[model samples]
Target: MTQPQDPQRSWPRFQTRKPRILLLTSQFFLLGEIRAACERLGVEHVLLDLQAKEMGLDDFVRTILGALTTFRPDFVLTVNHLGVDREGVLLQILEALDLPLASWFVDNPHLILPAYPRTHADKTLLFTWDADNIEPLRDMGYPNAEWLPLGTDVHRFAPGASGRPDWDADVSFVGNSMVAKVLGRYKAAAPGDELAAKIREIADAFGPADEPSAARFMLGRFPELRDAFLELESPARMLAFETLLTWQSTLDYRLDCVKRLLPFRPMIVGDKGWKDLLAEEENWRLHPEVSYYDELPGLYPRSKVNFNCTSLQMKGAVNQRVFDVPACGAFLITDRRRQMDRLFEPGSEVVTYADPEQIPELVERYLADPAARKAVAEAAQKRVLAEHTYDHRLEALMRTMRLTFEPAAQS
Candidate 1:
């Protein structure tokens, strides 16, 4: 591969004009949505034409250098730190070019950020969808970490057309079953009985708590995991254990929540793992996963109550469904999250359950009361249009980035 050397690239210039953005391309759905938002806001931008995975420094530098010459972005943006190599090659290249990288972490930053051994506080800006993550990220060596919660693409997810007959239900939940996720990680780690027990204990404890991390929880509650974890014998294995347990915990929590919905015969759309989770039960309808762009928007409106259960990895963060379903003008009955109060007014704009036990009753109430459901759904749609669209988020991010970084550029 030919490499570009000593490239003369323009640094971040947060000037009077709308700052041009160089959107890092990835396999993620968010990247496409961000591109649409950029177009909606009439922001000048370019998507780097390159796959981020398994990329070497030479190819990365060359591609970014090629884009910089043309796009000349004030900042390079990507979600969940896409295009960022674990070895820090991308960070080093960007830092050398004096280009600031704004990474929005939609997933758990704890699981993702630790893999980056090389990062610069000044050259990188971290935004998290979880408000609870802001302080923790600041503690994790990123001083300028900001809260940027996920928002719906109002134009795409808004209420309009009728959904497919097959997709219609009293309640619907669109998400991965986490069955394969937990199993794959379990097989990869192959922990011994003692370590596996440690995992089980941590996961059981982790699933119910407000804390997002079992590792952080273990420091205070369980001491024996340290010795048991040493048996794994590699940092990769340890990280695998962390990931495995998190998924396992989520699967445990989700399975329980979904089981409660079995009485309602909820239409579940996601990976085939759901069949495995609901193998014995014949009540619920499970469909293969649908595309976010093609089907989910239509599917959300068909359900009187769109069920939501957050992942254990996200302790306080509201999942995408909290925004998507409501934005579609579909009523939602979600498990209560700590940040629900800020984004939504539970019991009115959106319905929330404090526990799994409360789910069935909430579902029954909302499903029975069509007028209440419509009112709540309409209220939620209004709120989403006014505040939680990608338009609002991108505009806010543009203003915040300029206010936060423009002075630094001039300095």
Candidate 2:
């Protein structure tokens, strides 16, 4: 079995010319950022839009093959195996052709990647946004798994972009309230009343801890529930249960945070699910979901402070908002994640709250001191421009590919 090259060794200039990359485009938000990075780095790329639901599986595979032959791309890239068929035909085809496949996972890979059969192809490289996931992925027999944190497209999400007055607010949050959707599915697929009760009990016991620890606590408290959960026998059923638990945790945290900031009348921008959560709260304004490209860039800059409450799905990792909000030159107050300390200087570049109780004090402090807020926002924006742009991420990705596979290909 092959291993990646030593980090100390100087990487060879693996590409003599601009490498043609075949981008398997999907509905994922990061697709545009990836494409932008390719363009910025002068990589010739073609997009085979896999998000077109109209295309059948056979047609999708044929179209990919057709694009590959016509474009003669040096590598194929996709977000979380979006273009790959359930039968693993795409991996088989790529393996037969000896073409390299790169799949970057921005979401929880464990929940989705396992569902995609045949992920162990030798020519495939798996990139995850979380450092915690690297070991698990490697444990799953993927030797090429690597840690590649998410990046923001600075060009798109930059400061001074024209923003509407109506969009401006003191504190703003942009995300969905996944409670209804997740719980609805969980209830529909629940095995039995006894099992459902046990699950609820576990959820109630779950605190502000990481997923792995919470899982252990649940199993420790009621060992029988572990077998009951496992006995469901359907991966989808397991996924639904896990997802509901995470969302329920998030729903509780988000509501608590927003309720604390209700006096300030923080703006909530996302889905109608929030309406169900905050039906009587007229002080807190709710807006329809904004487009990432069109609205978020402008809105971030306009708001004094952007509150980033990460989904419960991500434990150690910060969400896209952490990078995007700062790139837009906005002050952000986010919940502290273990990984955030490495990403930004807390209190200087980015502000954070350890718990809901601390949120109101932090918000009040920042809201009262405009100079301090501006200074921090500017510092964060500078940091993002210098280090956290998509171009930097893509360059690192290319370097990894070159180091790992280029030497073997050349030999």
Candidate 3:
């Protein structure tokens, strides 16, 4: 998790006991993993429902306070700042109560955090999946930003039999085509004709570049976008524009990378967008999206090779598939990222493509040699179990939190 490769670095620990955490629950997938991690570590937790968007202010406040009183938590945990509202209601309550908040971000923070208030930046510890986000988050007023990369619930993704024989394929890639997502965000932003044209040109240029944040990359490459940026007026509008471009660039980039799979006749398990993108292409099989917790575990084992191309926002970081596919004891062929060397041993533990052109060759070679794929999958699973489990990540999070916010009780 870019958690340092050296053995000599001093690490923190909970001095008194494992702290109770009040979990702000959502339908987000990571909450389940975090809860499992807490259970594994013997940490106490209680949930506060934040799933309803239309919940009144009275209910929101009452629910939060009730949880705090009952749970008596040492900290409050959230995913992607879900309960930490942009209007600062949650932030106000937490700061008033002196509860430290831990928000683990798995998405592009540039597109998410700008909407949230920064009242308790110091107390709101940010654990980002992307290491590239650390400095940017720090600049964005979260001084306590840290990197805690994605990991798998090994038991959930463990190697098992594939119940469906039809799942067996030379290659399979499970991900959104981003066609609807890009278009949705773009329409929501609703830029004027001239601004929309400028935005399109910027997204077109940004897709192929090796950059992290779309806003920074756009302004750095073309200063003129800054004027169009200011024309958006509201902070929310600016955020919407940046988010739309990010998804648009990702759609373009991912399509180019995934197109390489066409000749291999890959099985694409995703939304209708795949059909929208590759209409009537007879080469590949396009199956509707599968449930991550249930179907993916089975699908990975049957497929000879699993392909992954990350979102453009994560320029130098690995995504969940890099961890999950291996944990399933299946071979994955992913695009190379800067932080990859920190996670896997590259050629031995994992196979990577520095260019999309290399994908077909890698897929062909790996598929032809089952023994080689098996060896690499075994190696990757071993590494994942050892250093990249949810438990390991929670251990690191607890250690860091204690060092920064919690203090040991003196006898």
Candidate 4:
């Protein structure tokens, strides 16, 4: 296959003899993605369901040793959390094992630092491009650390024919605005400012701002944004409701940062806690969240353009939607990220807005020019399928480990 430029020095190639994979994850949520990737690569994979069994530190270590003995995996893949206490048992096992290992750090690595082996692991995969993480990995003596953005299963999020004569607006967003606690973590106003700028840009693009700039903008050009925000009594009510529902869905503050942002859409499928939250919102057009791998490819195509917004921690990283939506050959309009241009050509493969303000106009432009939208989506789908598929990732990982062991094999 083609070599991945820069992020990692080269792509990992697949081997005829599938590598045995041992996946250790604290959350049950990821068990699906891990299984799918392994199945596609034909790798022998064993998943230790820590959440289901309520497995913790010492138990996890004993389990890893047992798996290594039984499965004889060539590599280990751990989720963000490594171990429970100091001199973590998992960390110890990794140090002793001759096999290579790596982690997909989907969470903020800084918050969970010190759980990782300071001087072990062949490589570490990051979700965002944070320069700060590099120094720590270097200090810890890891051989390699690089950003591998989060992705969605394209087959699961595929497009459906989402045309309904009675749909509310030409464009819509299923998300909330909760800024307080987000600021507490990053101490940055990018999220708030970006949201406001998106609104303003849409207004200016449509027409001159009047006394009620939002209302005037909506009344004239983007009636959708005005409709979405104005439906709530006030901004405070919107913010309060968002924070409250999020608390119900995610018991911990950590989960709230990511899970809470999802808009109150009837179609979103998640935990039972999520169903309870949706039940409270009578207006949402709720549907069961899909379970199978093939369902996603059917879902994303239903909308003209899907909306993606980022949390404070994920500002630098494109969410899974960035990859998944395009992979389905569905048109996507996403928030701006500095590195986005390098991955997919801007206004070509994917459409990006300078801020939320530009969303309406951008959406309008895409709707008006179906040819352009179709061309971009098709191009993106082709590019992502060629370079960014999970199989591509599996190949890259295997190739690296093979190279790491090549010298040893010769000796």
Candidate 5:
């Protein structure tokens, strides 16, 4: 009989033994998914919850170092650099110890990644959810920038799940009303009158354009704004302005998408921001936020059609809803994203609308055709189960890490 091939010969191992990972936990929704993925892969992990205790720099360093010494993990991982400090102490320590650190960004890296000072560490591997960001990240001098899209937990978000009747609806959207919060911040920290007016004007002109186009339009219209943004005087001012611009665009786009579905009487599950934003819309039903682990699993599968409006911050990337909705065996009508075509078969496994004008029509068509909706949902679920689960993601991540850090581990 022929000897069986070693699995390690096909796939590189991170270490001689099962790789131990130190997971820096935070309030981010993906924390649980990562933990579960590690469990399913039989990888040993230690969770260091940052929010559980308040720690100064010294305490933080001590705690992390203690964990490093005790757990002796091959790597330290976190979602979007949640537990990392702005001073880069954690990164410096990891670098000194020659430990591999992986930070997977599910959100816009431009906004969050810059906050970390030691982003260019050689041992640091930065994974972005958006493939469009890979070039930008490389341009930013990140040596190990990779495109790693988000995945769903198939077991948690599956079909025929029992959920509260209140959560069930013909059309449902689960996201935040970010406009109010973002605009409120901008208003409080408004630049001078001239700059503020220019900001408003540029924002008004930034309708329905992709990120690059919007940025170019704003720059073309108001060149001084770019100069002012780049000015070193009060960096916080520029950051706040950029945040406002991004959020304003997102809020406007999301509101427009939701408004298109007003005819469908969509149920919006999110924060009070939605209630305040659509206060006059009688057709929209707003529910309070649901816990990701406890409630969202049931809610996603229960809804007939789960809607996803990708945030403007993520232009080419699909949001978590794109994967989660399908994994739940529910039909998803998400705004068309360039990356969606690569992830799912458009109109078959998943549905997409390029314009807000098409949203209402698509919703109507899907609502009227239950068989079509069911077929697409089932197909999407199959695709998700087969290829887009966290297990697959974890395996890919490990492979990348091994190739980057331990190429010799491969036979």
Candidate 6:
């Protein structure tokens, strides 16, 4: 193994044009933001949109090798887990090239089953709910891993820009419920085939529902409900009980998840499972209403209080809306996480609810003190723009990879 050298004295300085950067991501949906960030940094970027490419292993490696030869980028960035299974090809070629590679992963890499590989890049940037996971990456050999929170693109997801009217209700949310079951029927006939068919049916019907997709669907189905859902009618207390009920799952677990739903107006959004779980309850607005990304920024701000609850596996990891909604200038009351304060100034910039029961009063208090809520949102936005953006994180990556790009004198 190559021994680690002292950190670079200073980053390479280029004249006229910015650094030539190559970003290889198979996820096409992320291409726009990656390109935008590169543009903002004045970096000349060649995006190998893996979604658009159609090539075999040999062809893929050859193409990447050729791109490296022609582009001669100072840096190459990729999502930690390539959507394409054929990642070995890309990694082998990039490693051979001695390129300054940076991996940006959005999820809590620590708990993901069959963990995303970490061999190719110099640094792995990840987001987490509990900030403590930073150490494990180093323990696992990714000494360069850093905690970078997910950032919402302020340009698109803003409340004022959504063109939707101000919502009338007190609190609202706009994100999908995640599937978090690992299956535990060791004795009773498994229901394996039934489960598979049900999943297949939903996949076929909804076409792989994501937050943006769900938001768009809602906008199309109930345009007027946008405001009502965005500014939901507040429940009896400050906190609302919310859950993404995996409809087909048994009531025991779903109800356990639901116990926290009603107190805060428990606005559940996602698939038909949530509806079935609620079974025509007066508090639950079952089907997803706010579907598009562009609409989220405005939608979150309309509510006096917005609750963000993550699925079990992701409970310790901060969701995109943790930053997105608040960055949109909304006061968010989120489930407690240890890492939250490290990312945002607690009490001042963001607020966390330790118990579901606390939400209602917290909401009432924050709403009553409009100026304090606005102050908190403003501070959170400032912090997000400064430290949590893709550009900011990219700059951090550049710093981490400075050793790779530094000149002999700087080294």
Candidate achieving the largest lDDT: 3
The top-ranked prediction according to TM-score is 1
Off by over 4 Å in 6: 1-18, 52-54, 83-87, 110-130, 163-168, 179-266, 287-289, 314-317, 403-410
Looking at candidate 4, the ten consecutive residues that score lowest on lDDT are 1-10
lDDT of 2 by residue, 1-411 (tens): 122223333223345555567888656547778888888789888888767476666666677667876776777888877877776767766765667888888888876766777543667888888877788777777878888888898898888787888898998888888767666867745766666776556666664656533445566776878888787678777666766666666777678778888888988998898888899888898889988888889998878878888776677888899999889888899999888877899889889988889988998999999999999988999989988999988887777776667756558
List model 3 lDDT by residue over 280-398, tens digit each: 57789988788888788898988889999998888888999999999989999999998999989989998999988898889889889999999999999999999999999888887
lDDT of each: 0.82, 0.77, 0.82, 0.53, 0.79, 0.55
Error of 6 at 184 (Å): 14
| Tens-digit per-residue lDDT, 1-411, candidate 5 | 222223233232265556778999656548888898999889899998888466776777778777877777778889888888777777767765667898899888887765678543678899999998887777777878998998888888776666898987999999888957686758655666666666556765665555533445567777877765555255456556666777777787888889888998989998888877898889989888888767887898777888989887788888888888888778888889888888899878988898888998899998999999999988988999998999998888877887788747534
User: Which RMSD values do the candidates have, in order?
Assistant: 2.2, 5.2, 6.6, 13.4, 6.8, 13.2
Candidates 1 and 2 compared by TM-score, better number: 1
Q: After superposition, how far is residue 12 of candidate 2 from its true place, in Å?
A: 16
Over 4 Å off in model 2, which ranges? 1-18, 54-58, 204-207, 212-221, 280-282, 408-411
Better of 3 and 6 by lDDT: 3
> How far does residue 151 in candidate 3 sit from its true spot (Å)?
0.3
What's the true lDDT of residue 76 in model 5?
85
How much is 171 displaced in model 2, in angstroms? 1.8
If scored against the real structure, what TM-score would every candidate get?
Answer: 0.94, 0.89, 0.93, 0.62, 0.89, 0.70
In angstroms, how far off is 372's CA in candidate 2? 0.6
Clash number for model 6? 23
Q: Residues 115-144, candidate 4, lDDT per residue (tens digit)?
A: 333544443433234433455555556657
Instruction: Give candidate 5 misplaced runs (Cα > 4 Å).
Output: 1-13, 26-29, 187-189, 204-207, 212-217, 230-232, 407-411
Clashes of each: 0, 0, 0, 26, 0, 23
Distance from true location, Cα of 327 in model 3, Å: 0.9
Model 6 weakest lDDT span, ten residues long: 236-245
